[model samples]
Structure formats: C-alpha cells, structure tokens
Target: MKTRSMYKAERTSLNRLPDPVLETILCLLPTKEAVRTSILSREWRYKWTHIPKLRFELRDTTSELTSDIETAMNAMDMYDVYRVLLLHRGPIHELTLYFDHYWEHYEAFECDQIILHLLRNHTLNKLTLFGLYETEDIWYKLPASVFALHHLTDLHLCTFDIDHPSIFNGFGSLQKLVLSYVKISTKTLLHLLSNCPSLNTLDLHIDDYEHVDNCTINELLKCLPLIEHLTISGDVSQWLVLDSVPQELPTLIHLKYLCLNQYCISGDYGSAFLLALIKCSPNLEHAHLEMEYLLEFSVVKDKYSDVWLAHLNTLDLCFCSSSLEIEFVKFMLARSPKLKKVSILTVVDRKQDAKMVKTLLRAPRASRGVKICTWK
Candidate 1:
C-alpha cells in the first residue's frame, strides 16, 4: 500500500549508503550502466570510479550490432576504453573488454601498452579480452606481458598469438584458460602450459594448428596433470591423426569431464582417439563426442586390454555415419562395465532415428544394466 512518493523517498535514502556499499552495487553493473549513475546525483558521480570490475562491450550476439559499432567507433573505441581504465582507482577484480580491432588506422602498439598497464597494475581475478575476428583486418598479437599476470584466476583471450619469451613465470595462480582462434606453436603452447601448475580447466577453439606432431604433442599434454574439465572443438585436423595413426598417447589421470565437438577426423582415428582418451581418464564420469570419422574395415575386439572407464555413467555419440564407428561404439558398450546409459545421436529424420535406436538397443552390451537410447 506504499504510495509512489514513498518509493521515491526510499530510493533517495539509498543514495546516502556508505561508499563501500555503493561501490558494491556499481561493481555488479556493466561499465556503461555504472557510469550512467553519475547523472543520478552528485553523491553517485564518483562512485563508479571505485568499482572492482569494469566491462566494456562493443557488440552483443547480433552481427548487425557489430557492424553498427564498426560504423560508429571508426576504430577509435580503444581510446575510450583506455580513458575508462585511467579513471578507475584501486585494483580491478575483473575486467572484460570485447571490441573490434580491425581497421586500417588501428594502433596495435598503443593497445598492447594499455593492456599491459591494466595487467601490471590491477589485481585481476578474471580477465577476458576477445580481439578482432579472423574475417577482419590485420592480425594483432597480444603483448608478452599477458603471460605475466600472477594474480589472474580465469583468462580467455581470442584472436591473437603470443611470442615466445626468454623468461616465463606467470599465470601461477590461473585455474582456467580459454583460447579461441589463437595461433600458437606446439612448443610455445607447452611452455605456457608448463608454467601454469595450478590450472585445472582448458578450452581451445581454433580453426587450425601449425607444425603439429604426435610425439611432442603427447609429451606436452602430460604437463597439465590437474585438468578436470577439457573441451577441444573446431578444426583439430592439423593435430588429430586423420592421415595416419597416433604414434604416441597421452594419459590424463585427473580428467572427469570431456567434450569433443565436430572434430575433423575420420572413423578409425576418431575411435582410436576416443579410446585413448577413455584409457587415460580412468575417473571420467561423462563424455560427449560428435564428429566425422573414417569408413574403413572395423577393427574392434571384445576387449581393449584391462582398461576401464570405471566411473563413466553417461555417453553421447552424435553425427555418426560409418559402420566402423558402429563397431567402435559396440566395443565401448562391451568395454564400459559401469556404464548406466548411452545416447546415440543421429542427424537423420525421425523414422531413421527410430531404426538406429532399435538397432542399438538390440546390440550386445557388457553392462547388463545399461539403458540404450537415441536422438535426432
């Protein structure tokens, strides 16, 4: 039963809250929204300066909005971001800036300096900077100082490459890292990962890999021993053994969650890759694998040694076509003793999906208690 005037009075009283409390409220808002509060009153004019986090977003999910920003900013938006950081006081807990850096007049060196300044001065817990897309102007490499953030906990950098540094001792406190369309050599990538001893999560999304070989790749993967959640999507054809066989296999003893999305590998290699992963991750609880594979002669036995996905409870197989893949699926069905449910996914119509489901339901399984299902 409160009148409209009473609500206004209550809201006006909120302006008198302690500065720390007001900064907490501002920290939850986006940088633009927080800055807008300055017009509310003289008391709120400087509250945004003390916020612990600042996020400047140039575009949202729509590509049209991206075009709009490109039209409006004319590639001068970096200065605005630099000014915002310059105005912010104290250590920023989190900073996420996503803007287009693809323009003929863009100053790559200045942007690099600005990013380095933020990393050097802030005690950031989460830092995400997504650079320009691949379909744009010249490529921009992130400053080597990005690897020297000792206070970062979660980092996601996109559309850039890192130069090999003479000395590396950063990302010691980092727990999660995500790289999208990042150009990195195997040797450099290994060196970076080796420095992050506390890292537990890694997500890689790239269109290609350079000079990828199995011998060194397998060895380097061993550097990340504590990773529990792993997601490798996009074009892995360069690293995945599609033209030949895996010369070496990497074992991960701590992995529990895995997702392989639309990898460009054939059936035999796909089956072999998944088997190798299952063998390595003994404690894996769930897996989602959906990709292309070879259509060669099936080579699967009733047993694949004493290896067991002992804790695995759910399996999702999607976009399968080859009969060799069916054998691999059957082999996994016979291999997983503790498996409780398996979902076979197909891109066919409802009738075809029903037929595949029926076929799989009739297939022999090692886990007598496992339920078989299908989806289209």
Candidate 2:
C-alpha cells in the first residue's frame, strides 16, 4: 500500500496539467531542460515543439561540461539542437543561441544551418546570435535566409561578419537593434538603418574598419528619426564629425535621452553641429555628453536662428577642464527655459570644480529653477 501511494504521488506531480498548459510551463525553461520533460511519459514525447521561445547557450565557464567538451560531446549537443529546430511546429517568437568559444570552425556550419532552418519555417520575432569565436578573423557569416523573416522585431549579432548579403530586403520591422563588433561596411550599415524605420532604441558598436562615407555623423543622424535613446561609441566613430547639416533633416525632434561616450569633438564641425542637433530636439529631456579630447572650433554658418531647448530638464557633461565646455553649460542654463538640474564632471586632477560650480551658478540667468553641480 505504501509503495503504491508513493508511485501515485510521483505521477500526479508530473502529469497534473493539460498538454497546452504543461507546454507553456516548460517553455519558460532553457531548451536543454525543456527537452528533458519528454522523459516523463509518451504524452510529452514531442510536446517541447509547442514552446514558442527556444534558447540554447553554452559559455566558457568553470563548469564541468566546459572543461571536457570532447568531439563526441559536441556532436551530441549539435544533434539535439538540430532536432529541436527541425521538429518545432508553431511560430517561434524569440531565439537566443550563443556558441561557446570551445567549438571549432566546423561546428559553426552546423549551427548556421539550424539557424537558417529555424528562421525559414517559423515567424521568428526576435533573434540573438552570439558567436564567441575561439580564433580571430573566424566570424560566422549571416546567411541570406535571415532577411526574409519580416516579422522579426529585434536583432542582436555579436562578433559576426556580415560581409556580403545575397540581397537586402524584407526588413524595417525591428524597433530595437544591438550590433556588437559586427563587420559591416558603411553602405550596408546605412541600408540596414534605412530598413528599420521605427528604430527608437539603438546601441551601435563601430570598429576601426567600418564608418559612414557619404554621410558624416550629423547626416547619418537623419537616417533615424524616431530615436529617443541612443548610444554611439567605439574607437573609429570617436573622431567622427558633422561635415554639413543636411538641406533638411528628419531630425531627432522627439529624442529625449542621449548619451555620447568616447566621441571626439572637433572644433570646426563639432560644437555648432551638436548645438544644432540639440536645438532640433525640442522635446529632449535628458542628455549626457562626454568629450574625449579638447578640439578646436571652426565657425560654421548658422543652420537655424534663435536656438532654444525649451524642454530640456537635465544635462550632464564630462571632460577635461575647458572654457568651451563651461560656455556650453552657461549656454544651456540660459537657453533651456524649463531646465532644473545640471551636472558637470571634469577629468582634470586637483582642478577647482567647486569654483567652477560657483561660476556657473553666478553666470546663469534664464532659468531660476536650475541647480548646478560639479564633480571631479
């Protein structure tokens, strides 16, 4: 009697839910763990395919599996991954697959095939592929199959080379994109941006080899109009400047949060163009600008008269001490009628930050609500 009761209890816990509800619960687990649910009974044999989100990731951690990834072990893992993609029936809403550095070049091909097959058959909405290559210059090229998944709304590719796509179409659905260390040319980059018409949040990582040619930084801003939050960083993009403001701009009028880190500001095209961009962003509420090195300012003809940032409320600037940056602080305090808070951080050692704060406190006039602060 005791043995029978224990057996009944075990079955009750495992097979308590309806098939649809059980599949939904299992989908919350990683793909590897989700597949194991089939061991419960014949009823769950292929139920894992009903999961809408499939994720598989292996990292180079101190785990025992990473320590002994033999050829047989890799083959088994790849087989399981392929089987999951091949059997999945419903529309996959998201896929996150990261290949550890332990895998060799040959293994990447298998993974690529699985990715292509998954994207082709399913209405995949979000995809993240992190190819942590063990060897340099051994980047997994994205297949032409990815472009057709028009339902895709988010994409993230890390350390992948998108050298020559077979064709460029079936895009413009993505609203959030993150490309970290992707090898794409300027032309291809622009084309990609043009496709994402409603891009509101962008995190772009530019390499020393990739840059915009026909468009300078200012002109490139025109490509993204709906951007409310932006982060532009990396070595090559640091020194980029605005050659000329466009005849007309699809400006960042609605942009409210902006961050520019490690970006070089040349005096000639830097100061005015930045001010012009800020003026265009009338609804901008928060801004953080970092200047890497002091640069000369060249006089550009005014693109717009009566510069006003009526909606700006907070501004943060960090850089080595300079009179120009201070002038910018004073400029903001005077122009932004709704300003309330400002922060200035100087990279200089033993500099008079408190004194600078006092100076800004005294020189500012337009907004009485503004509270100026400085950091060393």
Candidate 3:
C-alpha cells in the first residue's frame, strides 16, 4: 500500500509539470540527450522537435557518443539532421550550426545543396554559422535562399565568403550583424547595409580589407543611420579619414557608445576621421580609442582636440605613444566640463607614469563628479 502511494505521488508530480517547463528542461540537454528521450514514451517522441531553439553541431570528437554508436552515427549524414529539423513544425527562433572541419572531404556542391534545404524551411530569427571552407572558389557563395528569410533579426557569419551583394535584399529586419573573415567588395557592403535600416549594433572582425574600394567613411556612415553601438577591431588605417563634414549620419545622433581597438591613426585621414566622429556623434557618452601609432597633432592640434574633450563623458585611452599625455589631460579638464569619469591605461610597462596621471586627475574641474583611474 505504501509503494502504491509513492507511485501515485510520482505520477502526480510528472503530470503537474507544465509543457513549457518540460520543454525548457529538454532544450537545455544536448541534442543527443534530447533525441534519446524519444524512447521514453509516445509523448516524448515528438517533444524534442517542439523546442524553439535548434542547435545542430557536427564535430569529430570521439567522446560525443559511445564507441559502438559513433561509427553508426558517422555513417549517417547531414540529411539525417535535415530530417530531424523538418520534423519540427514550429517556427525556429534561433538556429546555430557548426559544420565539421572535415567538410573538405565532401563535394562543395553537396554542402551547398544541404544548406539550401535548411534555409528554405527555417524561419530563423537568429542564426550563426561557423565552419572552415574547403576552398576559396567563387562557387562557395551562400545559398540564395537565405535572402528570402525576411524574418531573420540577427545574423552572424564567421569564416564565410560572401561573393554576391544581391543576397542582402531579404535582411531588412536585421538589427545586429557580426562578420568575421568575410571577403566582399565595398560596393557589396554598402548594398547590404542599405537594406538593414533597423541595424543598431555592428561588430566586424575583418582580416582582409583589400576588397573595400570606392567607399569612404562618409558613405558607410550614411548607410547606417540608426546604429547606436559600433565596435570595430581591424586595420582601419587605410580608411580612417573624412575630407568634409558629413551631412549624413544625423540619425546616428542617438549613438552613445563607440569602441575602436588596435587601430592605427596616422596621416591626414586620421584627423579627418576624428573630426567627422566628433561632428556626427554629438551625443556620444562613452568612447574607447586604442591608437597604435606615434602621436602627431598635425591635423587636430587645437580645434579638433577641443571638440573631443568637450563632448565625451567617459574616455579610455590605450597604447597611445603621445608625449603630450599631460596636455591631453589638461585639455579634457578644460573642455569637457561635464566629464565625470576617465580611465587611462598604458599598454606598455610604465609604472613611473602613474604618479603624473594621479596629479592630473586631482586638478579642479567644472564637474566635481570627475574621477580618474590609471593602469599600466
């Protein structure tokens, strides 16, 4: 009688679990674990497919499955994964696929065929694809079907070659885009950006910049009118300049954060670029600049330097080789009356310079809220 009562309590607890709660628990498990649950009962068989977030990863890890099952799983292909995906009738809100590096052994055409199949059926709101391609051949362009998925809000592509610009027409709803090691022309990039009017955040990790021609800083800024957060880490030395104050980018007036790292600021172009930023982002609240070149104030000697110091509330300067660090500090104290916080980090080993930085921060300013921290 006690055993019967215990069984009844267990059944009650299982029945009390809401479908959403059960789904959440299942979603957190690995794909293999989720699939194995199908053996439990008829209700569990189709439960894995109901998960809103689908992640399919293919790797050569030996520990992924038991020794006996690994061989059988290896015999199966992407088609099996596609079948599993098709079983899910619900909308796929987030989809991530990490293709195995061994994809080079298969025909490129086969890979494209499989990817096209996935893109056709999935209405992905967020998608991330990362894999090593077999070749740099032009035939490696992303499946054209991707452009038809207008529902995608966030897209991340890493180590992929986007050879065509027309593939961007369907990304009008995209709000965040991250690209790494992508090879595309500046014209293509402009065309892509023109479609994403709602884009608010952009992160770029460009290893190659030779394809960027016939596009200037002003033209790029004009395309992304609503971008509020911009994080750029690459070789912008070639393109960092503005010959004229941009009439465009007024919409970027809402831009509040900017981060630039490992950027080389040299030549007349650097000055123009800095001036354009100061003029365009008048409401910028936070900025980080890591300049890796010798400091020469030829272009921004007095006029532009004052503009930066006046507007910035939080500023972090890293790896600057300027001899006039004190001059910059004095300029900030005088121009940025409302500036309340500052962090100066010297990338090189320079413990002796902290004393001078401390002295500069203690100076009286219009904003008594000002605080400074220096680290080497």
Candidate 4:
C-alpha cells in the first residue's frame, strides 16, 4: 500500500503536468469544484482561471433551504460568476449559465453586465443560457451585442428575446441554433435566418404563434435550404396552415432528420401541411412525430402524387390509437421502400394498442425487412 508521503509526491508530480493538460483536466470539473482546486497547492492556485470553457448553474433551493439562505446563496453564486470572468486569464471558447430562480424578482441588470463583459471576447464557439421560465416579462432580453459573436458555431437560447434585429450583424460561422420559447418577431426571425449561410441544424419552439403567420412561415422554410436536421414543436406546427395549405414551398434538399412535437395531422389543411413537408424532404432518413390528435371524420387521403421516401430508414410515432394515425402508418409503410424499423408509442388502452400494433404488422410494406415495434 502507498504511504502518505508517496501519495503527496504523486500529487505533486501530477500537478506539474503541462499547462494545456492541466487546463483540460480542470475544464472537465464543475466550475465551483475547479475553483476549489486552488486550495490544493501553491502550483494550482490559478490553474482554473485559464480554463477555456465555463459553466455556472444557480439552482433553486426552495424545498431544502430557507428563503433567506436560498437568496444569499443565489447572490453569492452570481457574484462568483462575475469573479470567474474577471480573473479568467485566457480566451473562453464556450460558456453555459442556467439560472433556476424561484424568487419573485431577479436583477436583470447584473445579467446584462455579464453579457457585456462576454462581448469583449469574440472567441466563443458555443453559448447556452437557460432561464427559469418562459414568460417574456421575466425572461432575459438579449442585448444587440450578442450578435457580434462572429465565431459562434453552436448557440442555444431559452426564454430570451431580442429587441433590435436592425443592429444584428449575423453569425456567419453558426451551424446549429436552438430557440426555445424565444419571443422574436417575424421580420427579425427572417433576418436572423437569412444571414446564417452555414446553418444546418435548427430546433425552433415558439409559444407565441399569434404574432407569426403562414407567409412568414413559408419564408422561414425558404431561408433554411441547407438545413439537414429540423425540429418544430409547440403551437408553431399548427400555425403552418393558418392562412392556407402550402402548395409549393422551397424544397429542403439536405434535410435528413425531422421531428414534430404536438403536431396536428387532422383535417384537409393539416394533411396538406404535413404532406407538403414530406414531399419536399425527399432525402429524409429519420422522422419522429408526436401527434396531438387525428380526427377520423376529417382525415384526408393522399393528395400529393409521385411522392416517395426512398431514404427513410426509421420512423417513430407517438400518438393515440386513432384510425387516422394507423392509416398514416400504413401509408408510410407502403411508400418507404428502404424503411428498416418503425417504433410506435401508443397513448391508448393496452388492449387497443396491441390490436393497433397487430394491424400495422399485417399491413403491406414496401420493404419486406421492415420491423414494426410498439409499446403502450
């Protein structure tokens, strides 16, 4: 067994590792834990300050801690974030801040100041800021300076809104963007998408669909010609057919993965919207659809002709055991010649779900090797 002196010698030798290797090790630790390493030895005093990636999460302690204690801890955590940025020596390539505030009020001004400080460093490649709730009143308003990060490749913003898109310069290097419950106007949203030429992955979930219309939705689709993976959730999918059924929208030639959550495929208009997207995405390989409801009386037969999902390999559907949904499954099974697997998560009684699964298994498939799996 190793003695105390032997362990001390080994730790000293480990601490003497190259600065790059040491920084990498520190980066793997939590921001708070990394800061605690400064007390280990004199050599590790400023090691964490050079780490390129930093993540700070302020959690809510309403259940475990008293209100006063929780408030004090939150203030200290926020201060620590400021302290880390001030003492940080090198460039920060990525940063993530999650504020789980359950209090009635928060200092939005301090958060703005932190963003302002980050603006001085243009080397950020990935930035994720998630707020506690989706309300526009409490959500942090992203300043115009955020658009100046030209080197950003991946960005995820939740419950954030931009006031001035006119000052936006655009992210030319950005490839992946996720906007969850972001309150953005149609014009600003279009401007943001038109400038990102390299964007390939887009995950959009808009709660305020009243402000957006069908024409703007079509324009949004046009802006994402190079998108390979697309996810549309919330009420936005229903908004796709607000004005009229899409006849001819821009084809997403590069689209491979598609995910639709709480999307309605009921009625003629909804059917048209769904068919239009699938018709355009000829190269789609994987599709995940979570349906809200599919009315039996309103179900429309295939209107689009000469459509085939030749590249589709996997299909995942989460829906109630409605006849319209089963019909949709049968339609896809007949068209997807290369489909290998179909997974269904039924939101119905176990007996009804089993019967639905049996019906699907008996349906004629274009690909004889396709496997149908189901679970309730």
- The prediction achieving the highest lDDT against the true structure is 4
Model 4, poorest ten-residue lDDT window?
A: 295-304
Full-model lDDT for every candidate: 0.69, 0.68, 0.64, 0.76
As for candidate 1, its clashing pairs are 266-293, 266-294, 267-293, 267-294
Tell me the TM-score of each prediction against the true structure. 0.81, 0.75, 0.78, 0.86
What order do candidates take by TM-score, descending?
4, 1, 3, 2
Tens digit per residue, CA lDDT, model 3, 197-261: 88988887554566555456777788788888887766665433344545333446768788777
Between 2 and 4, whose TM-score is larger? 4
Off by over 4 Å in 1: 1-7, 13-28, 58-76, 102-104, 134-138, 208-217, 240-250, 294-297, 300-305, 337-341, 363-373
Best by TM-score: 4
lDDT of 4 by residue, 117-172 (tens): 87775388998888766445555667555677788899898887655546677889
Ten contiguous residues with the weakest lDDT in model 2: 67-76
**What local lDDT score does residue 376 receive in model 1, on the 0 to 100 scale?**
62
Off by over 4 Å in 3: 1-15, 25-30, 37-43, 60-77, 106-120, 133-140, 165-170, 239-251, 264-268, 298-301, 305-313, 325-338, 362-367
Runs in model 2 deviating more than 4 A are 1-30, 33-50, 58-76, 86-90, 102-104, 133-138, 164-166, 210-214, 235-241, 244-249, 264-268, 297-305, 343-345, 349-351, 363-367, 371-376
Please give the lDDT score at residue 369 for candidate 3: 75
Error of 2 at 200 (Å): 2.7
